[model samples]
Target: MQKINVLGALLVLGLMVQCKGDKKSVNKVESNAPITEVTESVVDTTPIIIEKPENIKVPDGMVWIPGGEFIQGAVPQDKMAMDHEKPAHKVKVDGFFMDVTEVTNAQFAKFVKETGYVTVAERAIDWEEMKTQVPEGTPKPHDSILQPGSLTFKKTKTSVPNLYDFSQWWNWTIGANWKQPNGPGSTIKGKDNEPVVQVAYEDALAYCEWAGRRLPTEAEWERAARGNKSESIYFWGDDDSILSQKANTWEGEFPVTNNKADGYEQRAKVKSYPPNDFGLYDMAGNVWEWTSDWYNTNYYNELGAVNGPVVNPQGASTPYNPNMPYAKEKVMRGGSFLCNASYCASYRISSRMASSLDSSLEHLGFRTVATVDMLTAN
Candidate 1:
């Protein structure tokens, strides 16, 4: 217990915090619309590609996406777009089988070496399910900050003061799970293709129920991160000028200068870069995935008030974040390596966020999807 302090303020008052558990006491949180970046230069078009499902059968590491319609939310010409990714609505998704990356660390260490399992950051927090997400009594946090850890990102020597003060770089390390990402002696050995960072969303739904597959519906992860490049803003179309050859972001002043310059300063391996026109790969930046929906900052204004195309939305049944509204979020989608276009560019594709299904970080990771009756029931 007790390790969480690289100074993300005491790593969020400690307990390797921000596993979102907090509500009932918020004073004024009613802010959503000012996130508009639109630097105005993107007009490439010509993508409409959608291919895969030609003879069907696709399985192996997985790829097939293909379904149709797009416009999920706010990449209307992304300068960064956000306000819960806005009324850039009209959705629809049905052609499945995804995973061509971001589920590595040797496939979650082979589903924890055949299901011995134990992950929500290596277990141990239940303050009676975290004192019903803090407010009423909220007292129980002392066994040196209640054991088992996860958050881990700590790297700043100059620029902090804001980026919403994510403890200036998140720490809660303890043993920083997913094979010691930066805690303990730190290893993931030869990296084993990176992507399995700390994992929680019920440990990516117990590794998508031991690998049959699930967790993609945020309209199937914005239609496989928009492979058809809908109106394009990147899914290999809107020219971020090949953004570091196609995403692994945070190249400069994020938590005081990443300077990894895309050679990787955190979470890279999953395809290392280059795959979007539907082949999939890291899907945006390197981490921050997990979908099967929920986090509703007004669920895209109720799916942009549904005039049509909202099929397969499975998202806003609950969980809202007027900042916190007491915790329980989900919908995560790409954008990690701390993302930066001067802060949270979220590697573009309608970038959304809101994590906390008992959050886990290091960068966050997920990637799974399937159909054909979930691979014909395995």
Candidate 2:
């Protein structure tokens, strides 16, 4: 067995990457008016009406976000917002389409049957790759040998913590993958509707390629999540309180005891809850969606005062916050069923998180995205 640092491989790729075409165009607007005040009673007889296109139906179980500019990041007043979400900036995204729900067990199984695609957890690790990740002089013990790894929840109180330590609910169990999600003895015999878990970043990429789509970049994901709303904390607004009827998140004493108020103690069906303003479901909770950007805490600080960054195809190479651990993990957006008010509140649309490249967890899943081509006059 060999040890290879996944971050090193990514850094190598980042160096050779070429600048791609700019996705957002810069525009300037001018207005001239004299300051004046009018009383509410001054209005005579005027009617206001708005219209929208009727043919804007997104693919079934999906939503079309007419991309534009929005303030991205945290508000100065939010005490709970992480520092990474600071220095709010404006971001403009082109029109694109996104999944209304995360990829479910049934969908993943179909892909497997059609392409015989084995998840990273199911495949044996290559010795050469392993050697590149692990540091020299580290003992290559038999227990540490490459094997299938995925997230698992310990139902027992003694085995799991009641707090936000992910290590409590997530474990790298050997022989755990899509088929054997709970280690060797478990099987996906009846969980066809559940979101597919135990998938690595590469596994997701493979699925995207097979489906003729790609993972959404962090910016694109955020835009889709915001819908047509202004710069707000959540996809809906600045509210942080959990609405029992809206999402599928934890609703009791953390890991020790779940009240199941949301009608679920574990993963729920993808479309179990109400959809967002754009008719997208499970965007706030259920499972975190993967993004193409690397995790960086201060990336927003570089964006302009309007909260928009320069139109660049790729994200920063280094993590934004130097005080934090070196970011070897890719970004995961949208929270999961495990997210609760007490722990891991990241299920919000703007919340961000990351995981090791080779790591897999039952609580993590992903959705697909594609560019929306506008019909042009020939």
Candidate 3:
């Protein structure tokens, strides 16, 4: 058993508090903080944009985003769009290829077998690690590290109006991972075809490296989701009412009652629904895809030229300012199947969310991307 330290417990408590607030106001921050300098120079002169090669054929079920400038934010009418998506800007992305579907359990299983990999959730916490988390004299909290790491949605006895109090639905469960998605009793035996859940950012990174792919940057993900179309509320178009047919989202009352109208109570199979114009499946709703960028609500404000010099925008290396204490969380894009209009309306193309780097959940998964060079080779 590992004891829960006061500091660590307090940190977790604070995160719960922060997550329950109005996302827009909770993420907003002042601009006075000096940006940390990085070694990489911002490319002022837009590198000569290369067109998608004529002979380039992505693997069996992938698409080539013939990357170019696209309006990358929400329109005024979409009350569903979060404030972080404001100040739409034009972003140019180099040509790249992205997976058409999220990584399925079958795909991840292959990677694990080949590498003999163990996910972060499977590792046990040593005394040193436990010491860092538990307060002095506190009894161990039942060996958290040894326990499988994942968030399980717990149905509440009473209907609660506060949708933001995710604690009502989210529980840190033991024995939950890509294999045992729902905790101890669950198994992925027959679900090898479904997208693997309970994967952290690091876990996704390892898979990408093994496959010679990389996580898509925030800008690249936005452009790919749009599929050369102007930014709209939904990936297919501006309509929020088109969810059931276009994507799998929570169809009924969130937390307590899920109508399962989309043919799934939890996550559905990848490509179980239709694909967008780019032939990308499950981009709007399925599992939230991980991005390489660190989250910052005001990242768009620094876009374009500033101070009379060509201002090159860079993603945050750490967490966004307002949420700095929760810096361990990484950015996740493309809302999951659990997302709904009534609770989390983040299923739109440009919407964003995040989770702890070590946190895993059934609603989270990832897609891979290849750079121009890698795409050319393929």
lDDT of 1 by residue, 1-378 (tens): 211212221344543333232221221224562222211212223333355545557878887887677778766567567566777877655577788887888889988999888787777665665656555654565777667777788778986655554665777766678889778888899989888887778888878988777888887788888876678877888777668878888787777767776788778777778787778887888788888777766566656665666655567666766655556678788788778876667888887777667777788888888876566555
- The worst-scoring run of ten residues by lDDT in candidate 3 lies at 1-10
Measured with C-alpha atoms, the lDDT of residue 180 in candidate 2 is: 77
Clashes within 3 Å, all models in order:
1, 19, 6
lDDT of 3: 0.70
- Tell me the lDDT of candidate 1: 0.70
lDDT per residue (tens digit) for residues 31-130 in model 2: 2211112121122233211222355445565566665656666655555566456556655566666777888888889899999987777666565565
Q: What is the model-wide C-alpha lDDT for candidate 2?
A: 0.62
Question: Which 10 consecutive residues of model 1 have the lowest summed lDDT?
Answer: 35-44
lDDT of each: 0.70, 0.62, 0.70
Q: Write out the backbone clash pairs for model 3.
A: 2-140, 2-141, 3-140, 5-134, 5-135, 148-175
| TM-score, cand. 1 | 0.33
Candidate 2 Cα RMSD after full superposition onto the native fold (Å): 11.6
In order of appearance, the predictions have TM-scores of 0.33, 0.76, 0.87
